[model samples]
Target chain A: MNPLSVVVRTICDIFTWFIGIFGIYIIIHGHMTPGGGFQGGAVVATMMAFLLVSHGGKKTLSFAKPGLYTAMETIGLLVFIGAGLFGITTTFFFNFLAGQGGVFGATVPIGPNSGVLNSAGTISIMNMAVGLEVIGGLSLIILYMFKGIRLFDNAAESGETGHDR
Target chain B: MKKRVLFMIAILVVAGTFWGALDNIHPFGDVPVAPMDDYYIENAQQERSVNNVVTAVVFDYRGFDTLGEAAVLFTAVCSVLALFRKGREGQ
Candidate 1:
């Protein structure tokens, strides 16, 4: 029974890692391709849920930090919204600001039709915001779920068995 | 047992085939199917201030979706609260 459980858990881990990678791939290539922030974020969140279920509570969620996740989500959204307001002069949501151009760790040509994946403008910044918000928010949700389940189970065992804390 | 597995596989195959067919059709392509044109990008650009059109669509344009997502978080919190609340009541 133990061995079978281990095998099932291993398979689940592999599937979850695949989900995480696919989610990230969609987010990063959001500019050139279609997949962007919200879709990729949900994917990552589901992957986190998978991880929490496969691994024990301590291993998967002991590090659950609500404050940090909240901060990241708030900051990421602020940045995303700020980008839009800063571009208020030209267009309502023109993303063609400093964040709009750069190559792999290098700046883009600082002109029109610069490099494809350069960190210019609205797309990259927004994707980043989505990434941060989704990863933190989703993980927190799943971690809290596990915490609730564990608490309920423990309480039930204690109450039913007439045990003292 | 074998019949059950085969039946499940048959259903999966039909579903997968339907998905592949839709993939060819490309339902989300830039066009109107029934009444409204593919207002996805237009709608997105109109609402949000974000540069990435998609982000605007999710965060600003469709603020309700974000709210619903927040509700999901709240639901999870409520579940956790239930466990603790019940225990405290007993004690």
Candidate 2:
């Protein structure tokens, strides 16, 4: 699990934070922008992959836990479901909060205009939820693949060849 | 040779289908005449108070589909974890 070359690690260290911030902005402003939860989440996950690839498996694994990612994924799904259930008085996934004049409930004009952050009822919540879920899912996938590669490398080093075990 | 011919025929069929589909598809930068699209565009701002009609459609109007998508992603994560759990434990 040797660290990557000095240049790559340095660049990753410098740029990962900005990448993460951009992704969060995309997710949070999804209701008013073109990019939504999934796209932004993928961007953040890509940043994670970049860091993992640059830092090596052992260090990356030590920095983050698979359990934490699984928990995040679960929480995201639960939040999404809960938000949907909050609208169940009218329908399964009603926009109960829209036009109610509160947090994430401001009404917008009928035509094109500047977007408001505190608008769009459940959409914003769902965006954040989906973003979290996607980030967790994609990062976990990359981590698992890296772990498998590391395991196979170890097995080979130990001279334990073949698929018997 | 038989396999090669079959492969060529398959490629030809797929290409022809794509070509036909592309021919029928709306031209670039042209909006399709969909009442649902018009309805969403006209009503999303008033109904959902969101500027992005796409988000309104996805997270509000068609939330069940999003739930299904989330379920699919969760299933994938579960499968990946199940496959790699033993290796992780061994370490």
**Candidate number of the best lDDT:** 2
Instruction: Report interface Cα RMSD per prediction.
Output: 6.8, 0.9
The residue-by-residue lDDT of candidate 2 on A1-165, one tens digit each, is: 455789989999999999999999999999988998889998998986897778765578778877888888999999999999999999988988898988888888778788999899889989999999999999999888777675446754785433322
Query: With candidate 2 superimposed using the best TM-score fit, by how many Å does residue A5's alpha carbon deviate from the native?
Result: 1.0
Question: How accurate locally, in lDDT, is each candidate?
Answer: 0.58, 0.86
lDDT of 2: 0.86
Task: Report the lDDT of model 1 for residue A140.
Answer: 66
Candidate 2 off by > 4 Å = A150-165, B1-32, B87-91
Per-residue lDDT tens digits for candidate 1, residues A19-113, read 98899887786654567766777788787666655555455655657678767666666666675566678764554444323442223332233
- Quick one: how many clashes does candidate 2 have? 0
Chain B global fold similarity (TM-score) for predicted model 1 against the true chain B: 0.46
DockQ of 2: 0.73
Docking class of 1: incorrect
